[model samples]
Target: MEGRKLFAGARLRNLRQAENLTQRQFAERLGISTSYVNQLENNQRPLSAGVILALVDGFGVDIARFAADDGDRIVNDLHEALSDPIFAERRPSRQDLKIAITNTPDFAHAFLTLQRAYQAAKDRMASLDDALQHEQIDALPLPYEEVRDFFNYANNYIDWLDRGAEALATEIGLEGGNHLKLGTERLRGTHGMSVVFERGTMDPDIYRIHDPGAGRLLVNADAPRATQSFQIWQQIALAEEHDAIERILDEARFRSREARSIARIGLANYFAGAAMLPYGRFLSAARGLRHDIELLAERFGASLEQVAHRLSTLQRPGARGVPFFFLRVDRAGTITKRHSATRLQFARFGGACPLWGVHQAFERPGEIVRQLAETPDGERYISIARTITKRGTGFRAPIRRYAIALGCPVAHAPETVYSDGLAIDRAEDYDLIGSSCRICERRRCPQRSVPPIHGQISVDARVRRVVPFEIS
Candidate 1:
């Protein structure tokens, strides 16, 4: 930072545009001349320390994040898109990509959007028989992807909902009380919704059924107490904080009604998680416990997945947590849920990397597996993975299986209990991993499923190696 000049003109300009401020207005707010702002926005001059501090003070920007490489994901996505066979003959150079992103990031985003649509179309084409049989050929983005991207861009923290849930937690005296009892009491008192546990009478697939007409909430008596408490809190969210959730939905402006509805449930779930583990108390406990997930889960009466997901959402403005990334992957390697407050970005189009410890968690269930991993960009992280098994009520009932991973950058590893005896300074101990096989730039990896799409390769019939071809 002392000698390295950061030309973040595109980011600065995008920030100004988002705030709807003109160059003169932005300059005045920063106590700088319009010409200087112009030069900075145009990349004619690098951002000075004074300018950076001024921007931070005036706009409440996170100085640490402001200088971060926010466009790294965009650049990576662009590389993946350009690797398509259609662009094989005219792919832009890596330096050209950096310049384009620095000068015109919006165009890069638009190109990525188009490329995603094209890829979706190609995938649909591959299933032409099913598409024709079901008459379901459509190029619109998947609702799940749209919602996932929305949460990703929002940094997985919805301020209004979080505050509302925190307030509700305090109001209901959940700090030291049993969450299930308190939540049920609040539902009955505030919404006139009495809880009734239906043992064998409840439908197997339905965890909870809200009966507005009867003023009753029928919950599966056999479900885990934590899950029942979660359902109760979810109802509280819809009943108590409906307006806040709706306001966020209105602002999100999802492309389809299905996406909006899915997002609606997602927001409710978020509220449930936040309310169950209120922010201030949770953050204090996390720091005091050095972020011991097992201990935190036991204290909060939350499942491992819930605790991990809640930990990732502790991104309040002045009271940030360890900046962990939470991810869930199914047995077949599909990423079902992902959110990263750290620099590592999950692959956009596929499963977690085959080499990632999250995938290995499936092989060893019920145990925490820790790994020191380095991405292709040289950033190292300390991740812990474990399998989450959802048991069915009956022996014949279907069981659900998944694995979850939570991690943070190596710089913050000292603050986590999981990093107790790990060799943090040993570079050779870190396992080199990547976002996805198709976009990974690593030249050699025994676990690679496919060659990097953006690199040249040499294949020889007489050659035998870990992989069929050598990447150049």
Candidate 2:
């Protein structure tokens, strides 16, 4: 196989098929003639990386997966792949590279887009690695709760999944009963297809694919059976009943199309997690365990992070449990993940302020840190964060790791074990905390690093404000 164009044609073809648009139809979507689409797909012509950008930007495929031998690595791989021998003679000049990346409409999709995340993490890690005097620092403080907040918006999907698995463990143990394999067969019998696990993937995340003509369904096989089962159920739900998911995406005051797309994907992921961890039973078990995340993990065969995450998602229309916000952030204040189903407005831009407790979850691996934060305005909430490791459980696995966090308003304290002897401050009678230093107006905030939004103008050397910021 010619190396330089490795998977480019295949990716474009896959995108066309996935969109259910004929080559002609998809070409129309890209505003390119079918001939151009043909040339690209058949390898008669190569798609500059810009075109690849258009595929993701114009359509909704996760870009991380699109340009991969598998979806696991990052942007650097895409850059390296293009430098392969296939393009030896037509070598993309530095000028070509610059224009394609910056000027090409295809690549501009990401340019105008705003996810500084992966880059931010890389920068922060590099900084920390130097400061720690190690190539890869063993640990940097993480904002696990901020990651929780990412999921909180969708009702704590992590916990929904964890709790769901736990309940299944209780009702029917997680020990391999050949049930997972057998279950897939049963669904295949009903749906007239079976799961497909493609090794050396371009996209590592689990997914389901259907072949209409052959009446076959393909599912990524890397996940645990529980995860596979959950994926199957999720695909079914969205395919059959996507009204609610569509509604949320359509309805939210999303700031950008990218955010909306991310939200839709997030919402679908949430729904699937919910179906797997049906809210009622999981919620009851959580309370039953007195919020012991470890016990919940064992019972459900889920990661500790998973159980803690679901605890925050106990929100349903009538059965509304707790109003919680979850977050996952690193020491540099970059929020890697978050969810919010409550009025808990998360900071949309900027890294979260360093003063929050979620950032500390990294320092205490496998240990839970509980904090009571009272906003400058007098609102209080309880936050809990912990480190959860993610890596290959078997030989020679890739290392993907991070921490997670959870927080809910004080009103919901009685329902959680975190309430045990937790100190609540007055004036500060609540856990004095704010979502972001940039937006928060808390003038006397001790936790404040940079003063709140208007704090800079308010400070006078003579009339220095108590919070280290000035107020007129």
Candidate 3:
């Protein structure tokens, strides 16, 4: 592989054009003839080590631009898209797919977009069919999903809001510990807002509520310390950063008023998290502690879920932390929250892979379960999951239980404490995971709920397997 030559003609051409260099000018800089440069740019000739070094030294081009081609990503996405049963017979070969992606990237993207729309439409039709049986049809573009997609496309980080929150934290003297007290003080002093905790005053289900007319913010008396502090910061964000929040909302152009309103709340929650864990200090602490969630939660007075969510938002340019995927699931295996900075994407309409450690975390609450997982696409990740329980006040009160999972690519596993005793190289220790049963291609999985789309199933009367039928 090392001796193999690299041919990235399109990328080389794009880079040269970006730098406003012509074939003659580029050739002079790289100590090559114009014809040779043209040949390389046209991919008639493969890129050599000398040319790569010359490009790096002469033009300061990022080496990764050539090393990690977007064509590969396009190919992977295309392969995944084509895996649907609809195209089972017409699926292109790997080399053919690579050629399509490399030669016609725009057409490839258009095809991917069409496939996504088809999938979305299929999902909606299935829901509609179900609704016909139940006689209930829900609205399109669900508010929660809309907000989730908004954050997903933004990579779970809003630079402006993050920086503003950090500045506000500093102004409120939230540094050097005691963030909850500082948050409370800021809400009271800066916003002229009073924090009130009273049992049975507000809705029993509502955690926090603000009454602008009364100039008071009421929180549930039984709320945890982290929840109380988060509510305080949320209030501050709505009061002090209302203009900024609205500005982003305007730019977002959300389709519905409900979505805009929900997004505003989500943005405020983002601000609260950022304020509670100031970006600079939190990143420093995370690196120093090797991203120990428990230690960070204890040090920052945050919940494990909060720490995990914050870890996924460390996509700040030039000071980025490890790209992590974060997810939260309830006891019934419903994914409550999800964001991935890595290549992994959660199921858009169904439960996650049963083989995932997050599902198992419910069996052993308070314990961090780690697993090396490989997706169907051959990407390996190091995942860690733990159950988070929120206790209720009264004897008969309902308690909230959720499990949060955080993971990054296997290449980053060495930097985290969870990987200390694990053998990442052992295939037996690695769990084979996927997005969902319907989309997963593992034919022999015992836990599969449904046969994969387009899969052929055969049943033999004499054979009894874990699954009733064999899938091919």
Candidate 4:
């Protein structure tokens, strides 16, 4: 008996074409024969569990993607096979099906075989359900947050950035990057500046451009807090070591032209932050200031967001500081930029957790609010959030709304303004809002559109809502 194959072979082929890599090159990376890679792409072969894992670990393919459309078909068929139309029908939940894929693929394979036979018997049933309209559903993309969360812990890159930022700050009076000016001899004679902007014409994405004439580049004021500080950091990175950054980003199998371009720019910025906020020096200052953002900003001549953004980038190696992540969001709860040097996961498609102080800061206007949160792993983090509103160049122009969140490990919580005995252990009762639909676990959330991955919900006719149906 045969069933629908993963179509993964087809998707791989598409990705390969977009990347412009030959089968041999792809095969070489996997340490497999070109023939094997060819056969797999042509659908003449099925992806083994080990091969799937290898693709995820080595090539950065999201394992959830492989389990999605390809695995779903198999699961649907298994359920149909296990069902008994005449009597005591047994139906497996999607969770049970997922466990089979994650922990026991061998069992999954056996179930698929049984499903094929059962489908043969149910052929009559398929014809009877004549109201069916769409038989072929386009496969949905993988859960992006899950994949990003995986990478968030892969290395100590964040610590390096934090340490590097501090180290450079200590050596260069903590105002190393601030001295740069646009289109000046101070830049040309020693450090120079360049100007660049985002693609659109209306809103400003005006950022610092790299200038060959000037010794140093100028950062853009129009960028978000993370991007602004990062550009400042990038300027610093150019003046220092360049090898490590080139090495790390070189390994990516970027999805498209856009991804590669963003990755290039993003990695360079990461290196720059690392260069400025060198671990040891920055951590010392952080402890000295007790992570007081305003004081740090004044001491370093950085903006409020600048110091906070740096506070989160402190991931060093053996002599590590508290791992922290930072994010900037607007009034509509749109996250413009985020960078993590910690275990906390950032939503790729949506905003952030609503119960956290970051979202609440919008209500306080210019005031800073300290809060705490717990992740799925039960690790607690202390977060300080505030609203930073910048006026337009003219009264005619619209004012911009923004929020900054700086967070650190719970052990360092007491030092930060966030850990004020807020009982952030578990807010199970509060609504889980501001997250990508793909990775969120809050089935009872009033904001979720699509149910979270593997979640099952039963809508009762008895209830209606002011918000979306809550998932648990």
Candidate 5:
């Protein structure tokens, strides 16, 4: 069999642009004709072995990665996006999608971005309509959603903030030490902020309160040790890494001030987690422990949620860990927190598929529920979910509960402790799950709350199945 031809026009053009060279200049450096370079950049010709060698030798491009198309994800996202009811009349075939992505990847990406923006706007409008029945209000982008997209597009890893937090952690000896005490000392000595633990009757919902004017920080004594430590580190982030966080926000270009403000809190929280876990040490420990959440939490003095979230952010350039997606959902199936470093994206608007193990986690609280899940796109993942409860200070106070899930591609399953004794190779063992009901194409899902938006359903009087109608 002959080797597959590599038409990496986008990659080739990007590589040339990165070197600040024109097509002619790039061709000259590669010892190729300008016409040939043009043809290659325009996808009119495939990259030859000689050209690949020249790229490796001259531009230091990894041929394996440079020649790779990364279009599978784009295709999957396009399929989901086109599955919207708006495109019900005309859906492209899988082959058509592959050709589109391969030929015009940038356009494909822009389309996906537009689809996301449209979905976000639709959700926001619906929310505003629900809240204001008679009043005329302008529907604007939701701050939380904007911030979520920011982190999601960034692959849940803010490199500058992560590195800065890691350096600060190292400077302050946060690893293998009393993190809370160290963080408190750092706050007091560096920022001249007084730390006060309120043992008295504080608000049940309040965990940490900071008074910049008074230069004092108040913490609830009844809160967990992990919460206390995290809050302290968050303060340190605001105090020390304010410039770095501001730089990130400036580049992010949030639509509204509310989004920017929310992102500030999110970046602070990210810094706290990064500082507490400190990328290198956490990654090493996680690998050593086979990515065990409980053991890693214990080792880092972090909570399960923190550890799981940190695991998703381990997407450093060279030294990367297993790409995992972390998610948190409330009892009502609302996604409170989500970040995916993998291709398995969560539904942006509607909640995840009810069949997901994360939803089942609520049934068996405290017990880790493991699942081998396959998405509609045929990607398999090993998901582990457990319910977490945040208790109020008193018995009469309210308690907040949520289920958090962390998972990666099944290829990385062996690196996780949750995969023990599992049927990794059994195709029948994998549960079929979809991104959402609106985008899911599965016709036989018994738990489907609604029909797929893009398809026509026939409701015959005499026909009854697991679903109410047949999808066409």
Candidate 6:
């Protein structure tokens, strides 16, 4: 495949300015001509391979720093933000947005921050309206929202906590096989906590409970084997890695005590997943299998959701896997869990696009549904979805169902097993999807639930289509 030309004039200018070097000085450091540096900084010339090498060797600059296409991320986010109803008629063009981002990145970032604050405030107002209807207005910012924002800002990867978990896994010898037995043994030998499986002994609502007085960890027998193993690992993380987890929480400096407590649980869950799949082995296995979730689950004794969630956390600096976005949605399309190493952010207020294959996964239980999706800003992704069912204790007990979706950019599709036999190059094969209907700009979508926020609605007595009115 031919490589695309890299024209990062703004980034080059920013780097030079940060080092307090003039164009001639920067040229001298890079061993390049002043005119060539001027041309590169003005976007008249693309960054050549020799210049990149010079920049790396002469200044010891990290190559990955320049490799990031921050302009694309900024453009995508700006497009989403401007799709709001307030800018329905005065949205900026794509070229204008690119110029704004390239010429003034700081201003673009400040604009994005203001837009995020607006969205958050809008969400709070909606919640307040709902509360007013029920005559109960609680608070401004919820702890759950704070926790979600914390994870989102961190790109869903806690590097220190992940490394700590990896070290703990090495200490416990959790490598070769039978990870479940290894976890159980570690808990019993190191923590002096006996594992007990008691059916109907604990509340059906709780999956695992630790009894300090009895010196036992009680797991619900109704849970699956994978769940049982995960519960054991979670308890081990809470008991053994309490100090490390507390240090992370302290460093986080969450706004509220409740947020800190919730974050502590989240960090424990991260450690449990890391301990169960131990970074090196899991990454190697994933690459070998081309990230087949079921096969990986079978190999690692993990659930499908666990395997998918683990894939999103493989951003360990030098040993990163393919960046993926993972999401779990219930039947009503409510997103229960979300994480993105990609640019695709989930809508904060509503369900995902109805056109997405994740909604179809519920209809076909246990089957992996594959889709080629294109976002609003022309980004293409290969998405795979499968329904996961959780059985209750008794025959009459209600069963819970959820569909998990995992996706990556089309450029990375070749690295996944789900992309096999897919017509990735065919544009017609890709479904045009967006983050949400309110923000979508697709005018004539048959599955649209509501009029687009940035579209003009045209109603006529003579004409009628799938929708009640035409969007202009």
* Clash count of each predicted structure: 0, 46, 0, 33, 0, 0
lDDT of each: 0.85, 0.56, 0.82, 0.56, 0.86, 0.83
lDDT of 3 by residue, 220-282 (tens): 888778888888888888888899999889967776889899999999999999999989989
lDDT of 1 at 54: 87
Q: In model 4, which regions exceed 4 Å deviation?
A: 1-178, 181-205, 210-233, 239-245, 253-257, 375-379, 420-439, 442-453, 463-472
C-alpha lDDT of residue 387 in model 5: 100
lDDT of 2 by residue, 434-471 (tens): 66765575555666666443334554567554465553
Question: TM-score winner among the candidates?
Answer: 1
TM-scores, all models, native as reference: 0.85, 0.54, 0.77, 0.56, 0.83, 0.77
| Residue 458 displacement in candidate 4 (angstroms) | 2.3
Please, what are the lDDT tens digits per residue for candidate 5 over residues 241-284? 88988988997788799999999999999999998999999999
Using lDDT as the measure, name the better of candidate 4 and candidate 5.
Answer: 5
Please list all clashing residue pairs in model 1, or write none if there are none: none
lDDT assessment of candidate 5: 0.86
lDDT value, residue 264 of candidate 6: 84
Of 2 and 5, which scores higher on lDDT? 5
Model 6: per-residue Cα lDDT over 1-472, one tens digit each: 0266777777789789989999999999989899999999888888898998988887775555454455655676688789887886788987899888866776886786577668866766776766655554334345675677567656677766677778888886775356668877888898888888889766666788889898898888888888888888888888978998898787557767898989888988988898888888899999999999999998888899999999987876567899899999999999999888897877766889999999999889999999999987699999999999887688776688999999999999999999999999999999999888887878878888998777788899898788888888
